[model samples]
Target chain A: MLEKGTTAPDFQLNATPDQKIKLSDFKGKNVILAFYPADWSPVCGDQMALYNEMLKYFSKHDAQMIGISVDSAWCHNAFQQDRKLHFPLLADFEPKGEVSKAYGVYDDEVGESKRALYVIDQEGKIAWSYLSPTAVNPGADGILNALEELEKK
Target chain B: MSTLKPEVSSSDHIEGSDAASITIVEFGDYQCPHCAHAYPIIKEIEQAFGDQIRFVFRHFPLQESHEFAFPAALAAEAAAMQGKFWEMHDALFENQYRLSDDLFEELAETIGLDVEQFQKAILEDAVKQKVEDDFESGVRSGVNGTPSFYVNETKFDGGPDELFEMLKESAE
Candidate 1:
């Protein structure tokens, strides 16, 4: 997985059928990249729902979060609309799991992304990262703590 | 692995013992069905634990999904000013399926809150801010979803059934 202080690799992924988000575009803003296995899984559903409720907190810290998964933009659109997700869920499809692999969080054996989190600083350097057990909904404490540390510096 | 960031404070709407060793804080959305499902179970836990537990409810509305959530939270906070927070809180969860924008005012009346005062309170900044602040605290405390629980300040990563079972086992 990506480590703190590493310059996060840039990528272009689909946010919606017509909208593409570039990692480099968020250079001046802190970004939370949450790479998970798939959409519609029970744990991922809860994790996204939890983050959906937390968009304001992320915004308060001047941070934007984008969820990355192998799910297609169409799938993400349906899931986001159905779940009422406020943030974007980028599709790491096309070349499936490309972004997840760039972040070194791809699970080759499982054919899915490992549940991972990366808090990238304003300069695009990873400020913090964590690898969570697949079934565990690794909540937002780590991400908030990293944001707090960034503000302190 | 996470703990409640700011800890339970005087502003929290609390039920049960002040001297309780087990304090369970729930960050819940009034319109979330999962929260509604856990509602009876929560009441059961309070009954089972009795004076041994302090139950605190904090607002964490997902306004995007549940449009009535934030308004419901506002209603509860407005009721809090009239010392009927729990009464309005119960009315919300009990009628979660029928939640709507107009439901808050009706609930306020049902709970015996001064109807005119309740209507005015929801329009007040302090009442709205209280719910928003609770949401911030919940986010900082690692809350990821409705019905998220923190027991004695530590996040409990389980469902209500698992939570009650843990408490039951620990009390033994």
Candidate 2:
């Protein structure tokens, strides 16, 4: 997985079937990239729902949280609507695990992205990264703490 | 991130003995179906374990997904003012299917609480702050979802069923 102080790899992915979101678009803001195994799974569903509630707190730190999975744009759209998620769940489709691979979090054996979190700073450097166990939901504290640390710099 | 933050104290709504061999803390949303599902399982666990285990419940309301969640938490805190936190907590989960703005008052009345006082308490900033504090504590404690449980100050990886199995094993 990517480490702190490393330049974050950029990518353009589908936030929706008709809308594409680029990593560069959020240059001046901190970006939270949460890569998980799949959509509709129990753990993933809970993790996303929890993040949806933390949007207010995330915004307070000038951060934009985005979820990434190998699911297609259409699948992300359905899941986001069902979960009522405020953040974008980008589809690393077509090329499949292309983006996940660049971040070194792609699970080749399962053909899914592992449960990983990356906090990219406003300068586009990896500020923090965590590779959580596939079944565990690694809550918001880490992200919040990292963001808090970034503010001190 | 896996340890229970601040630890359970007198400020928390608690069940069972402080001297109990095991401690279970749950960060739950009142209106979440999963939490409601865990409610009965938790009751069964409490009944099965009795004084051998202590249980604590903290609010982690996902208000956006469950509109009645924060309100229900506030109602429970309001009931806490009357020393009826457990009563309101049980009533909320038992009637989770019909949770709404009016249900809180009805539940308060059913719990034999002073309905007028309960209503007034829920509107107070203090009650709201208490619920928010619970949520902040949950976040700090690494609660990832509704019904997130901590056993003996460490985050338990599985659901209530798994917790029961672990407890049963230890008791034997």
Candidate 3:
């Protein structure tokens, strides 16, 4: 529901290592904000793995990819450990659906987040956002392509 | 025997071989209850078909709704690194609701992974990225839901009986 070029909503959530990650912290860098439903699904695993493989590309582009989910920090920690993930997965667990709602990825009917990807520019403006139905999966290349296009600006 | 390969992304490769003439590619989430429901049906089909068919699973975690799905996927991948992927995969689905951190660790221990190394691997950003890439691939291929299947590149629009019939046709 969020449009491109709109200001990304501000957020402060717990990330891995029991630290807090704030949206404003990356004020001068591009951020690939991905919202996924849960931790241990088939498509989600592949999706996160794709990003892990492309970590270098994101870094080369001076971008940070952060995944958001409603799982607890401990769950994220376990997930990160298990997958050898190279990115941070934030814990949006305390308020349960606050961050997801702010991002408009929350599925109120199911009490879970929708599959949505948001590309936030260095200035904290949303450069791109994609929302897929609960049953479909979203692409990492599309995100990379969007970032590439945004960098041309 | 017929062999069908599901479309794969540059980041992933399917490496199993069975003499089955039919191949089924499942775009599923471990966290989605619906997928969990389909799990047994897939198992039944596999048991019934055995070497006659091959089943491939692709990651399509709906991170929006099921909070534990993605991380649980990573855990399965980590277990896979130890050559215990299928074991871990089965365990995850069997214990879907208890996907807390403590539970993950317990599961790792139960599976005999080096707890310290396993923990380190899961926290590594690289691991999460791999899962992310899989997700991106799913989106690219127009997968919008869990338990979506492509039988020989033809989407499965029917239920279990329908899927079984398709499998039979593909085998022929």
Candidate 4:
């Protein structure tokens, strides 16, 4: 996995069937890249739901969150609508796992992104990163803490 | 290995003895069925332990998926302002199947709160901030889901039944 201090490699992924989002477009703002295994997990430990609730807090830190998965754009659209997720769930599909691989978080054996998180600073440097246990949600604190530290600089 | 961050303090909404031997803190979402399941078991645990256990409830609403979660939490916070948090919390869990703004107001009336103030409190920024703060603390404390429990400050990675068995074994 890529470590902190490396430049956050940029990628363009489908946010919806007709929309594409490029990571480089968010240059001046902090970004939170949440690389998860998939969407529509059970509700009890639903990571996406947890992040949805934290959107305001992340906005307070001036950070934009994006969830990346190997799922198709249509799948992401359905998941977002069903969950009412406000953030973009970028489809790392078509060239499946291409973006995930660039970030060095692609699970080759499983053919999905590992449950990972990255706090990309406004300058596009990786401020911090964490590889969470696949089953755990890896909640908002790490991203918040990283954003806080960036503010100190 | 998870531990409670920002330890339970006087500012916290505590429902049991301060000097209790065990402190069980729950980070819960009012709209989550899993949390609703833990609700009765939590009551049973408190009853079984009495003064031996101190209980605390913190909001960790997953508002994205559960539309009524934030409102439910705000209802609890508003009820707290009127010294009726437990009453409101219990009412919410008991009526989890019918959670809505109207239900919150009705619950407030049933609990004998100043209904007008409770209604206004639900929209207050402070009330929302309180819930948000609790959620932040839960996140920092490694709470990944509703009804995440901390026993004596350590995360209890088990269900209500397992927690009950553990507490029961300790008391024996």
> Model 3 chain A: which ten-residue window has the lowest total lDDT?
A42-51
Candidate 3 lDDT by residue in tens digits, A1-153: 688888999999999656999999999999998898888765433566556645766787789999888888999899887777878999888799798998888988878788889989999999888886666456465676677887798
- TM-score for chain B of all predictions: 0.98, 0.98, 0.83, 0.98
In model 4, where do residues sit more than 4 Å from their true spots? B114-117, B120-126, B169-172
Candidate 4 lDDT, tens digit per residue, B119-171? 89989999999998898899888787788899999999877889999999988
For model 3, state the Cα shift of residue B51 in Å: 24
Better of 1 and 3 by TM-score: 1
Give the alpha carbon lDDT tens digit for every residue of B31-134 in model 2: 88888889999999999989988999999998877888999999999999999999999999999999889999999999999989988999999999999999
Q: At residue A94, what lDDT does model 3 achieve?
A: 79
User: Where is model 2 more than 4 Å wrong at Cα?
Assistant: A42-45
Indicate the TM-score of model 2.
0.94
Quote model 4's TM-score.
0.91
Residue B8 local lDDT, model 4: 95
Candidate 3, DockQ score (0 to 1):
0.10
i-RMSD of all predictions:
2.7, 2.2, 7.1, 1.9
Counted clashes in each candidate structure: 1, 0, 87, 0
Best by DockQ: 2
Q: Candidate 1: where are CA atoms >4 Å away? A: A42-45
Q: Could you tell me the TM-score of candidate 1? A: 0.93
For lDDT, candidate 2 versus 3, the one ahead is: 2
